[model samples]
Target: MRSFFKIQFLFLILIFISARLYSQEAENEKPFEAPYLFGSDTLIELSITTNIKELIRDTGKKSKYHQARLSYQLGDSVVSMLVQLKTRGHYRKNKNVCAFPPLRIKFDKASSSYTLFHDQDKLKIVGHCRNNNSRFQQMIFQEYLIYKAYQILTPEGFSVRLARITYKDSAKEVKNLEEYVFFIEDFEKMAKRNGKIPIYKDRIHQNNTMIYEVTRMAVFQFMVGNTDWGVPTLHNIKMIAKTPTSRPVPVPYDFDWASLVNAPYAVPNEKLDIESIHERLYRGYRRTPEELEFVFKEFRMKKESFYSLYQNSDLLTEKEIKRVINYFDEFYDIINNPKLVKRYFIDNSRQVRYK
Candidate 1:
């Protein structure tokens, strides 16, 4: 009788164990939709549908998120990825300006951060701000090119893909329109690539971190005529660090407001002396002359390589190309000059104010 009872208990335990194993297996079998993103220069074409008028109409409230279908070419066949779409950006709220509002695409975080397949990680799509004029279209492309230029400077920067996005009215209320936009790599993926983790700690990056890389990023921002970032407030920048001991790296985005892209809304900060975003002010903290010189040398070596990107980019027409080159020429003039370094860096460098 004792043996029979013991055998019965063992049997019950095995049954319970088997049931648990089956449950775990079932969960694993469920489809984990993720995009298989790869390296290619191929321009991706995607069709996205959302109720634009409704989103714009409901200004004071949270716009309802919509299910959007994003289709792209893969190998020999077309593929589709499911994304949650919503209107995004600060300037869109202003009544007088009808700039094309940006979009925020949300993906299922359970899967990969890439957007190539079924993944639903968060990504921003930059498109025309208003009127959809030819010049606005070019501004969008200029922003795209600016991102490409940053990519040439560092692997730490966001990877952007030129996308020709077609906007279809889901309610069929607005006419179907297409615009040039770009997709940014997920921040998580970018940090993982460099063996770092994204951090949101509200401390200045230069306070207790490596100086060279921080200086490099600072100079790059100055080169692009951008002063629209602050590390402490986490405005227009993302920070990543491999360890607590290492300095955080900056991942910058939102260039439509940048002086280099020079959108209509772009303006210089009131606190800065310059009236133009085109004016370069070294926002970097003051360093020793030797230290600053080292940063200059690094930039000087890569200046040619960076300029070469604009020459190679076929997206801009001959006239547009010249305009772009001339804009950068103004920046190069400052960095290329030693006297300007004293005027911009030594005299203008901030210590505790920026931090």
Candidate 2:
């Protein structure tokens, strides 16, 4: 009897160990929906039926989400689901500036299975600001490419999937609206993919940020001629870290104002002292010469890939492509030359420390 009881005890222990190991494996597995949604480079075709006029007129009361129907094609079938959407973002949400504001989409997780949106809860959508204007559409495409460029620079960045969407108003008589839009990956999903926790507080200083990552972010912003982001204020940037005690990494977004995109509405901040967005400014924290060199080398290694983004595109016109490449040529010239690097990067870098 004693031996039998001892065997039972060992059996229970074995079962417990197996359960724990299985749980760990499940935790480590990749999210089931991301691969289907973001794995392919091809643009996704999607349709949304909602009250378009009402959505755009929202006045930031943090009002209720407007009901909508989202549909996309898969193989031989069309998948449709009920979704909740609302106008999001400050500048884009302004009716005077943008006819169509950016959107925040919430999905029904229980019913989101077996489709591209499987296991997805919420996702941000960036669309063209103005309707009936091809120039605005082209600007959006350029912004999407900027997101792609950052993704190439770091795995710790957000992943964006471009889509061509047709907006249909159910209640109004407006014509069908077609535009190029892109879906930004969920924040929690990005942090989990990078094995980090998303930091919500904006008080963390750049000195506490990871040296190599922050330096890379700063240099990339300078290359793109963006002076719009700040780490401490969390202005147009997101933060993440391995743990609460670990140094954070800045993830930048919203580049419609970057000189690379050159949207008409984009202008330099009055306090920045720059006359125009065309002028480049280095806003990153000061780094050691060795650290700056290390970050510069990474950009140098990826130069060809960056150029190929514009050279091998089917979206932009040849004229626009040439213009963009020429703009970046100036950036490459500065990074490659020692004297120019010091003038723009070292001497022009931000001297104030954000506490």
Candidate 3:
């Protein structure tokens, strides 16, 4: 009887060890799916120039154009990026006018700082010591200031629009800005290239029709700060624009298929039932816990698809998803406790039985 009991106990011990190992493997071998979708290899080019008169007008009173030029280049490998000046000129210096110094922006990869050069000196835009953990945040904050300056200096009717701004600041007080600039002509070019011609009926400028185009243009200006520009000054600014450029045909290779399939990056156009998952979890569904657990499991297994769904989904709330992820991390630790192994087995057994 003593030997039999020992054997039974050893079997149980083996079961527990096996369960723990399988659980760990499940967690480790799980494929990572991002909750956000990301684009790849899009090129954007921008050109910044100053017309003497527009500059003078923006400055308020008539002043001579001070031989000033401003330019910058930024884009993600996956997005089509371009910037062109529809109308940019200087505001003349007046009694009320502030003497704004010319800025030269350069990117420092080593420190990841945007050093602003003016009057032959460098001004480092460092984040408060609290933000030392995130160098990207510090650089973004500095870029935002530059965007604000751009908006203030540009003309109201200017054809060039800001596209996007991306910045980071730990202090809830600081807002990081990433701005994207676009031109009206570029839109027309895009439309033509896409073989979607604007239909004009009756009205001279098709005022209502232009509204969509104008709105898109307006949004572009806000997109500019999305990339890392080495420095925060206006000098050595390289503007890259798409400029009626030919689109390259994608060539297929056997290796490309493997890369696409095995890529750890987010997949394009993958559909996920994020709203159903969110609702089942939040609305007190009977299987809320199980559903939530499965949702995360699915996320882990299909990380790329999940990321694309999260990024592309307009129906789901970003805040809700963020909250769930944060909370789930803690919950996972509790359930995976070694002391609670028996309870975990019972719970998982019940889950499997129900399924």
The candidate that achieves the highest lDDT relative to the unseen native structure = 2
Model 2 compared with the native: what TM-score? 0.88
Instruction: Residues 238-280, candidate 3: write the lDDT tens digits.
Output: 1122232322111010110011111121122224222221111
Candidate 3: C-alpha RMSD after superposition: 26.1
Model 2 per-residue lDDT at 215: 82
Question: For each predicted model, how many residue pairs clash, with residues at least 3 apart or on different chains?
Answer: 7, 0, 70
- From the highest lDDT down, the ranking of the candidates is 2, 1, 3
Preferred candidate (TM-score higher): 1 or 2: 2
Q: Residue 284 of candidate 2: its Cα lDDT?
A: 79
Candidate 2: tens digits of C-alpha lDDT, residues 1-355: 9999999999999999999999999998956534467677788999999998887787485846899999989889988998999988887777788888888899987667777888789899988999978888888888888888888798888888999999999997778999999998888889999999999989777767887888899888888878888888999889999998788998988888988787888889999968999888888776666778888899889999999998898888887799788878988898788888788778877675549
The reply for model 3, stretches above 4 Å from the true place, is: 1-187, 196-201, 204-355
In model 3, what is the error at residue 238, expressed in angstroms? 31
Q: TM-scores of all models?
A: 0.82, 0.88, 0.19
Candidate 1 lDDT, 1-355, residue by residue in tens: 9999999999999999999999999999987555444255567788877776765554444765667666766679866656677777776556556445677777655332444644436787777767568778888777887777887777887778787888887899899888887777788888887788887777675655457777777777887778888766778888889976567877777777666577777787799888887777777788877888888787677778877877787777677778767867776777678788778888889876644
Model 1 ranges off by over 4 Å = 1-38, 58-61, 73-77, 108-115, 118-120, 353-355
